[model samples]
Target: MSSQWSQGEIYESYVGRWSRLVAAEFVAWLDQPAGLRWLDVGCGTGALTTAVLTQAEPSAVVGVDPSEGFVGFARGAVADERARFEVLPAAELSTDAVGGAVDVVVAGLVLNFIPDRPDALRRMREIGRTVGVYVWDYAEGMQLMRYFWEAAADVVPDDRERDEGRTFPFCNPAGLEGLFAEAGFSDIETRAIVVPTVFESFDAYWTPFLGGQGPGPAYLRSLHPNTQTAIRHLVESRLPANPDGSIELTARAWAARGTS
Candidate 1:
């Protein structure tokens, strides 16, 4: 629940891979025509922005994120002349900075982290000629955090405080749709995209959290090292015992699209 998104290595290590998978799914939702211009809000590491460029082949692509390290990583990863990266928050996007109307605006797994979600959505709408947004958060009852917490609870059963991490911002599909509607997006449609988060072993599963990238990382960091280790062991033990031995985490993300 820290507002700061300064953990660059953590983000790329823990969440960035899965985030890229979700971004690819989000791009599939777009009816991206040739020569479309795209603005990627909160384009962490430029994964989604790169996806947009690959899929849409837009006339120009601009990616913005609040984290300098993430923006820097994105700049280095994506070297297309038409693609640009900036260290700016989504809430600051305006018609003035963008020059003229943008053909499309895309946000990937970003809305939940922004403090002023409504205003940010509105700004995206204002700047976009057409808006397509994708958000992936811990779905209620199906959260990956639940796996960690179920194990952590054994160690710290009294800590009801840790639950708030699971409940942060866009934890449900209805909430996501409502935010879009409130922001004046019309013809909003939402659907669930399920991805299997497979890990080779407990170390593969738990190392990412130690990096402290997103909510899971944050929660892991809050614990003592002993408690963190215990939680990891517990989660590994609870994994469905497959002969192939890959831990499969069912991750659900909500994607919404509408006209500005």
Candidate 2:
């Protein structure tokens, strides 16, 4: 099934919180000097843009996303003089939008969703001296989604075809590196940024899937109500919850960067 990208609040409940953690680590990893112009391609509610403003001290940051709802949410959520939100797609991003060539450009947890990643990366390379991106290691290290999809396959084997792990094979280091290299970037590098994803209870975790904001959740919504409950129960049973019933999982994102 095609993924849903609108509905900022629902998407935030699903993965935006986790993406914020990855974005901070990702910005720190880039280690760019302060006072530079930055572009956040597929900014998605300003997670990475906020990180850049708070961590990197960029002079200015323009966040661009295809979803008007996401851009609106970002504008309201990130109220910084240095930050601006635009309703634009990654494929259409240009230096003009960011007010000339930017010093750094980054995409957080969004490369996998772009239909033409190579072209997008090429465009990113053109707009910034340094370009970086991070995507969830959905195939393995992103434990939360891994658990959900594993349980899903057990209940409905055909659903395995819809798993992000299977769908986003290029999210890994080698694949990311290849994309950067092909985009004519130099000194390419990649690393994993794993963070804690703690839910107060199974309800906190299960409820987000019901919001139907992304692929996994959208897929879950497609099933019969009974099947959805079965998947939820199977995932809950498998989770190693704490004595207080909190569920702790780690999300790992593969981050890559290169110089233009």
Candidate 3:
């Protein structure tokens, strides 16, 4: 049980906000036909599931997550009978649960977190005729969190190596496309999706880190309160702010899709 799968609301506050922005672009690039059956692996709050429903006409959608809290929230929030949520692991998906395979399978902000991505991707391919994935380009393309880590390095030089950006190098296109290839997918296509993450104030931007939703926020929780404050100060000192006290930043995610 990692904190990453703990609370859906806390995660929505941290990265879900930006994931929604990316989901639209991610589904747009999916470019699949309407009336397709979709399986949203690691759906997490139904952001991607909602994106698919909103952007395209899907006959049915099944969302799976190991987190019960997330599944519960998704079931309650997404009102369509066409969309359903289940507490299931990516590695354990089967034809029975997915209704004998879907037309397309998509995972959002999830690939980098899978313990065994090759196995998970293979399962995804098994559950759908098309398999796809997208993750925040934490290594380079996701600038907002990267900037936070950049400031963090100044405050706690000793902990710089553990930053999310440094640790998740597979967030890039090459890594993702390669995973799809390894999973026996063909016609693979990968693209970068960039979106803006704006905050009304610095506090608005930084408070999510206190939610303990992901590794970065979990790392923040590990530090002493004084150290956390120092990191916050460093981050604020480094960020460029607008006159109205708002901060506008961009986050990019690498997406890849292919047929099996």
What lDDT would each prediction earn against the true structure? 0.76, 0.90, 0.86
Error of 1 at 23 (Å): 1.4
Model 1 misplaced regions, further than 4 Å: 1-4, 141-143, 164-166
Instruction: Please tell me which predicted candidate would have the highest lDDT against the true structure.
Output: 2
Residue 47 in model 3: lDDT: 95
Return the TM-score for candidate 3, rounded to 2 decimals.
0.96
Ranking by lDDT: 2, 3, 1
Cα lDDT tens digits, model 2, 1-260, are: 11498878998899999999999899999999999999999888889999999999889999989899898999999989999888888878788866789999899888988988899999998899999999999999999999999999999997688999999999899999999998899999999999999999999988999988888988998999899989999999999899999998999999999997
Worst 10 residues of 1 by lDDT: 1-10
Q: Which consecutive 10 residues in model 3 have the weakest lDDT in total?
A: 1-10
Clashes of 1: 0
TM-score for each of the candidates: 0.90, 0.97, 0.96
The lDDT of model 3 is: 0.86
Residue 19: error of model 1 in Å? 1.6
By TM-score rank, best first, the candidates go 2, 3, 1
Which runs of model 3 end up more than 4 angstroms from their true locations?
none
Instruction: Write one digit per residue (lDDT tens) for candidate 3, span 88-130.
Output: 8877888897777799999998877788888888888888898
